[model samples]
Target: MAVHKVSLDEFEEIEYSIIAIHTPLEDYRLAYTLNLILELNLSRSAKDILIDIKEGKSFFSKYTFYDCKKDITWHLIQNKNEVTQRNNKKKATLFFDQNLEIPAQTYLLPELKKADFFLKIEACHNNFNVTKTVAKMNTIATINMVYSVKTETIKSKNNLIF
Candidate 1:
């Protein structure tokens, strides 16, 4: 058998079909109740979203959610969404490229806006299936991240800050 070596860059195009997600338990409650969700490029689905949270894998990614405190609205969770229902039935969705600013009011890890992410991401959504619009969810992932922080940029005011 001939031996071959694969380089790290080769995996850059790879994406996980599924992944596990996590966040500070308290944060999840607040975000969920507020009807805030993470913004993402999503494909449509048929039927109500039927995923097992106990399965430990979801579509959460590392993206910052902006102005959530200002944008939180009950309408997001109120259901009866004609747009969402249509998309799910049609099986097609448009790409939304913009992202919200990180919410600054959270007491939890306020300094970290986006979860440090490193993965082959296709796109993820949190739509009516999960109880809120996908646009308000935040990614605080805990699984399928195979790389480490190899380097971080340092800024100097006189040399120190984490």
Candidate 2:
């Protein structure tokens, strides 16, 4: 009789790049701007990234573009989703009782809460110039700032698998 065991190293890991974007423009507008500037055809995905939270499920907008020529896939996703939660406890006033709705924000990466959005670049067996891409994104007037984020420091890395 023989026994065999598999090691984690046997599995191939997906290598990707992360770029944090701080912008005031909405997701659609930002996607359009990126399309025009970066020559990418980013379109909204049919299904959004949903995360289960204590309050409720938070849906984050996702835009995707795949460059077949370069073998690179680009994903622009909203890092924050504001969910409105209704308070079950009713407030009694002089006139009547009222249910208050409070707005709660959920972040994909809690450590990077300040980042409005995150651009994920996944290149398979191809060289991608992240610095040049970041430079180009910085040219956009609507974007306040653009910078690279080290994936090693991300505690909630699983949240980005989608």
Candidate 3:
């Protein structure tokens, strides 16, 4: 896996080079890959970080903030279609495969601004609050300091669950 580091404005953006892997296939390590990328990019502390996942659909199974102590904000953009927001303080992780059994907490709205896809995921006590909307070929999810908090874990993992 190759890593590309670039700084934009006051935010730091990191793009991980990954081989395109189609969905519904085993041996998919997108979760682990994302974890590694986050770890590498997070080495330098910053107020905000943007991770652009434009390569392809990534399957992330775990996301932990054990080493992160700062109140960092993460903006995750996927395929320039979907986006997920998360605070560094809240230990966040994701787990899912082709057969997505987890229900979508947020759906993309059409009234909002047009984008590929944006989905915001804010880690709370137990569950994560999700907000999503779709426009054109994009889906958008936004989360700020004001969003309802839910109580659910992505993979039933102990690291993220309190």
Task: In angstroms, give how far residue 103 of model 2 lies from its true place.
Answer: 0.8
Q: What lDDT is reached at residue 128 by model 2? A: 76
Q: Who wins the lDDT comparison?
A: 2
- Could you report the Cα RMSD, in angstroms, for every candidate shown? 21.1, 2.0, 20.7
Which residue segments of model 1 deviate by more than 4 Å?
13-25, 37-162
When 2 and 3 are scored with lDDT, the better candidate is 2
Worst 10 residues of 3 by lDDT: 132-141
- Please identify which of the two predictions, 1 or 2, would achieve the higher lDDT against the true structure: 2
User: lDDT tens string, model 1, 92-113?
Assistant: 3385434333221211121222
Candidate 2 runs further than 4 Å off? 1-6
- Which TM-score value belongs to model 3? 0.18
| Structural similarity to truth (TM-score) of each candidate | 0.19, 0.92, 0.18
Q: Which residue segments of model 3 deviate by more than 4 Å?
A: 1-28, 40-67, 72-162
| Predicted structure with the largest TM-score when compared to the true one | 2
Give the per-residue lDDT digits (tens) of candidate 2, residues 1-162. Answer: 899999999999888999999998999999999999999999999999989999888999999999999888999999989999889999999999999999999999999999999999998875678999999999999899999999899999989988
Question: What is the overall TM-score of model 1 with all chains considered together?
Answer: 0.19
Residue 20 CA displacement from its true place in model 1, Å: 19
How does each model score on lDDT? 0.25, 0.94, 0.26
Per-candidate total of colliding backbone pairs: 8, 0, 25
